[model samples]
Target: MKKILLTGATGYIGSHTALEFIEKGYEIVIVDNLYNSDISVLKNIEKITGVLPKFYEIDLKDKQNLEKVFKENKFDTVVHFAGLKAVGESCEKPFLYYKNNIIGSLNLFELMLKYSVKNIIFSSSATVYDSTAGKAPFFENNITGKTTNPYGTTKLVIENILRNLSNHKGLNVVNLRYFNPIGAHKSGFLGENPNNIPNNLLPYVMKVAIGELEVLKVFGGDYDTEDGTCKRDYIHVMDLADAHFKAFKFLQNSSKKIYEEINIGTGFATSVLEIIKMTNEVTGENLPYKITDRRAGDVDIVYCNADKAKKLFDWQAKLSVKEAVEDQYKFVINQNNKNK
Candidate 1:
């Protein structure tokens, strides 16, 4: 079995991916700062997978501890999930995004070079896509330069760094550009755990259902979308997890010359209002919502062209939007009562 190192292993996506990797018979070790996540995720993962990752609780910016992890264990590949990920918060504190997302990642890359670990799969976001371009879906070959927000800029910058670094023939990198990741593990034991207020729509709707928040807030209902609101392709977190696992398979088999960037999404657009309506259907709750002014830097409509994943790795999303919401809602309610 290949030994895998996962950063931000206790995070929303990392937690789910950990379960998938463990099931695939990989020996996993994790490193997380716990800035916006809790250690209890390890327990949930152990319960679900019967194997807990070897964990180190330290900030990614801490070079001393990072070096120590590389020295102590042999990691064949790394799937970096460690970073600050709130869009609205990233705008307010752009430096934090750069430091944690970019500089911190540079530290990891340096360490990878030192340890001769050349393979990496990055957790990138679709926010790097050019939303202004006319399209039903964003293809892998689409000209994707104009990113809207600081969070997106950070993702784009890191991907570019991978491209340049790979040119040296020492590293092979895969940037898995993810769409809006929703849903929980089918067990409902692991799901999106936002640090504070949920920035993503699915988590926000779950928060409302769980009584942590009062109502859903639609940013705008006057856009040119089918529902007059922003539309996004929300891939299930589990499907996102599977895509990462499959991408790793491709990387493991490819020559060192391969450095690829692929999109992971359902290629199905769901509007803000449609998300709310679906939440009501799945959770059997009457949702309260009000249309407000559009949030700054939010794309009006964006779906992914997920064909690349199918052609490249035979991976595509299998769960529908409603199935994703159902599992996510289960986690929110279960977590809400525990907090109280």
Candidate 2:
């Protein structure tokens, strides 16, 4: 069994991936500062997987403590997921994003080199792609230097650093450039729990349905699309987690010391209005929403051509948009029941 080092292990995607790894019989060592997540998620993972992962409450920015974690455990692969992710927050505080995302990643990489752990699976975003460059359904070969926000810039920078390290430092790096990931696990015991206000649509919609938020603020309704709203490829969170497992297995046995990027998405575009409709269907509530002006850095239509992920990892999103929305609704219902 391979021992995996999962940074940001308590966060939304990280928590689900931990469950996936545990289910696959891999020993997981989790490290997180709980900056954008909760410690309660550890309990949730244990509840579902029946095994508690070895966790260290260490921040990646703290090189001394991070090194201590490396000295304690033997990790076959590192799934890098620790970073500040909100685009608006990144624009407001670019320095914070740079320090946490870039500097923290630098700390992790330096420690990895010292510990002789080379294989890594980086959690990346489709924001690295310049949607203005071409049509929708972006592929792996797409030119992606241009990004709209500092958050996206941080991901691009890390990808470049990993690319260089892989070539010169004998590192095996696979960057999974994911599209919009929504939904919760089937258990509803684990899901996205954003610290502050959610910038994503699905979470905001769920909050509105549960009466936590007043109204779902639809960003833009005048973009160049079928419904004049932004279109994105929303994949289930479990599917995204499954892709990480496949990537880890591929890296473990492969002979080539390669640096590669895979687009992880369903390759199907769903519009904002369509998402609203689907969420309403699942929640059984016609929640209130208002169409507003376009937010800065908002793209019209951005999905991915995930042919490479299918060919390379034999992975593709299996859940439909309706199913993803239903999972979110189920999670909200479960949370409300818990609070009561």
Candidate 3:
């Protein structure tokens, strides 16, 4: 079994991917600082997968402690997902995003080189694409580096660094550019539980349904789309997890060093209002919402052409947005029941 080191493995996508890897018979070690996630997620993962991954509470920016983890575990691949991800917060604190995301990634890459861990699967974002450069369906070969916020800038910079490393250092890198990921594990035992107030749409809508938040704050409602709202390609978190697993398999079977960027999405666009309506339909609650002004660094429409992922990894999203909404509501209701 190949040993995989998963950074931020207790977070939403990382935790789900850890379950996928463990169930696939891979030995997993998790490293997380618990900045935006909880430590209890490990217990939930064990409950679902029946295997508890070895975990270390170390920040990626702490090169010394991170190096200690590298020296302790001989990992075959690293799946990097540790970073601050809120776009509004990234704008509010650009320096924090830069220092945390870019510097931490550099440290991890340096350690991977030292440890001879040549394979990596990066958790990139669709935000790295230039939203104004083209239309809705963004392809892998589309123009990038015109990011709207500091969070996206960090992802683009890391991709460039990884590309350089792959060019000269013979590193195998796969940058999986992800669209909006919303949903939970089918077991309802694990899901996205942000530490603070939620930033994404589905989480906010779920909170409103559960009466944790009074009303959803819709970012914008006067865009050029049909409903005058921003449209995004929301993919199921589990499908996104599967993409990581497939990418790892692809790397393990590769004959030579390669750097590939692929988009993992459903290729179907849904609007902000449509998401709220779906949430209401799934939860059977009138999810009250108020549409405010347009947020800074937000585009009217941003979806992806996911054919590259399908062709390369033999992977495409199998879950529908309505199904994702249903799964998310189920998880939220289960959590509520557990608390009660």
| Top TM-score hit | 2
- Top-down lDDT ranking: 3, 2, 1
- The most accurate candidate by lDDT is 3
Backbone steric clashes in candidate 3, count: 0
lDDT of 2 by residue, 41-116 (tens): 9999999989988999988999999999999898889999999999999999999999999999999999899999
lDDT score at residue 69, model 1, on the 0-100 scale: 95
Per-candidate Cα RMSD to the true structure, in Å, reads 1.3, 0.9, 1.1
Each candidate structure's count of clashing pairs? 0, 0, 0
> Per-residue lDDT tens digits of candidate 1, residues 1-340?
7899999989999999999999988999999999888899999999998997899997878989999999999989999999989888888898989888998899999999999998999999887878777676888778777977789999999999989889974688889999889999887689988677677888877777777678788888888878899988998999999999999999988864668889998988998888888888987878898899987766677888888899988999999998999898888777877778
TM-score of each: 0.97, 0.98, 0.98
**Candidate 2, lDDT over the whole model:** 0.91
Return the lDDT, model 1, position 334.
Answer: 76
- What is the TM-score (0 to 1) of candidate 3? 0.98
* Candidate 3 lDDT by residue in tens digits, 37-156: 999999998998888889999999999999999899899999999999999899999999999999999999999999999999999999999999979899998999888889999999
